[model samples]
Target: MKTIFFSFLFFGSLISAQNSLSFQAQLPSINLWTKIPDGPGPGGENIVSAKGSVTHVSIPKLIIHQPENPNGIAVLVISGGGYAHIESGSEGYPASEWLKSLGITAFELQYRLPEEGWATRSVPFQDAQRALRIIRKAAGKYKIDPNKIGVLGFSAGGHLAGYISSTFNTAYYKPQDDIDLISAQPNFTAMIYPVVSMLPPNNTTHSFKSLLGKDSDEKDQAKLSVEKQVNAQTPVTFLAQSEDDPISPVENSILMYQALKDHKIPAELHLFQSGGHGWGMGKKGTNTGEWTDLFLKWLKVNGIYNSDQ
Candidate 1:
């Protein structure tokens, strides 16, 4: 295992009080391409919201949030935006903050938008896979257990987390460095209101169109759907969603849970009576708001986390 010590000064402009590192800035470079690879047509990234929702991302980044008391566990956080943009503020940052309370290090992913002009629709997957490898490769530096790294994603980002968890063995991009040699497979996965299927009754049209393109065929949809892609190697998973979620239907989570169980993968599902969708970290007064506690308990029960450590 190689140890990497980053010079935070070089990224002074990019780093806030919290650390932010671009994929392009990795020490040995685990970037997918030499530059932002072009897509079928013309376009560029843009920030669209005060909450830091962005589209057409050219520089995929990881925002690091370290706990004051390290517990040797880490989680890669991916926010959802239906593949159109990243909901970093609502999902990513808050998730990281919550994880920090447990002494778990968090790396919030600002992944590329497939809706942008990427050379392939798999660009987001490539970024996600690379991010996991980077986290594992830097385990020593971050004081994290390489084997304890997991992923938490919301909505479309949940689909992405599911994709990476189920398909980690598949190379989404050519190896770029030694980091690529590290396993991209997450130790476990947690998805909230994920867009799991591309077929009817559960298909999230916006996320589907953003990822597979407007002209994507049914075959393409079926092939890449996260639920359909689950295998024996898929990571143990924890899924939570609301029965009343108007956006990405509740059936999406059900389909994924079913697939995991069929493959004999250890999985947990939490269904809320209400809470709708996109309630990142959830609201404070509702039962859904207690999901963080539920997740922590689940982690301990699964032996994936040990607070006593």
Candidate 2:
């Protein structure tokens, strides 16, 4: 029963913007089972997304970036770390900055990484559910349209966003408060080169091992394969993946798109020729740098973003 209080993050003018709703983080009121077979031994930064990324995480926090001119659109942005750490600087703040420039409010959620002694397979989702519930309850303060709330996740986080969007109806924990009554469902979801399946061959072994142990049964893995979990009510999805992504196969996005298409769910897929994997908003010359523009256009096309709001 350890509790950790959150510390507010101030990134100064370079990373700060207007009209944000950064909530104070609290320890996990509800604990999910965990299997941390490997201990955190002298954790440090690992170069990822062309930036120094933290390698271990425990508590969850929200760092919001509101647009200078809000369009009543908000996206909860989740960073990817293969369930090992959070690329908060490269994947979290940078994305929020770009979204803010688009007049779309962005909430960067720092969720607990699996296999970190704080969570099991369901822990990340529980934290996501709680984060969304808080946003939905305080929608007005953030000046967002609750129904227009969406999720954008990078890599493993992308998998999480898609997984939560489809499985929002399943309750894995008891409600905590009035805010818990709010649904965690996203109106739209975006997965950027995500590890979408728990099944091997197409998915990353580390992420599945972190969430579900190496000894987990086939049925459990099948249950978490997001492509097979989509239903008629699943939200519209936007996927972006590099054809040559070394870590996560392009087939993950393809399988998810096919599932959405078969279920008649609105979906969009982008497969770049290069860009490799985990380029975080791209590294200049890469064509993946243009993904933000395409995402904005998609949002506008879906009427999720409007200048008039």
lDDT by residue (249-289, candidate 1, tens digit) is: 88899999999999999999999999888877664334566
Which residue pairs of candidate 2 clash?
none
Give the per-residue lDDT of model 2 (tens digit) for 147-181. 99999999889888998999998886677567678
TM-score, cand. 1:
0.86
After superposition, which runs of candidate 2 have C-alpha atoms over 4 Å from their true positions?
Answer: 1-52, 307-309
> Model 2, poorest ten-residue lDDT window?
1-10
Please, what's the RMSD in Å of model 1? 7.4
- How many residue pairs clash in each candidate at the backbone level? 1, 0
Q: What lDDT score belongs to each candidate, Candidate 1 first?
A: 0.78, 0.72
**In candidate 1, which residue pairs clash?**
39-117
Candidate 1 local Cα displacement, residue 281, angstroms: 0.9
In model 1, the runs with Cα more than 4 Å from the true position are 1-48
Lowest lDDT 10-residue stretch of candidate 1: 1-10
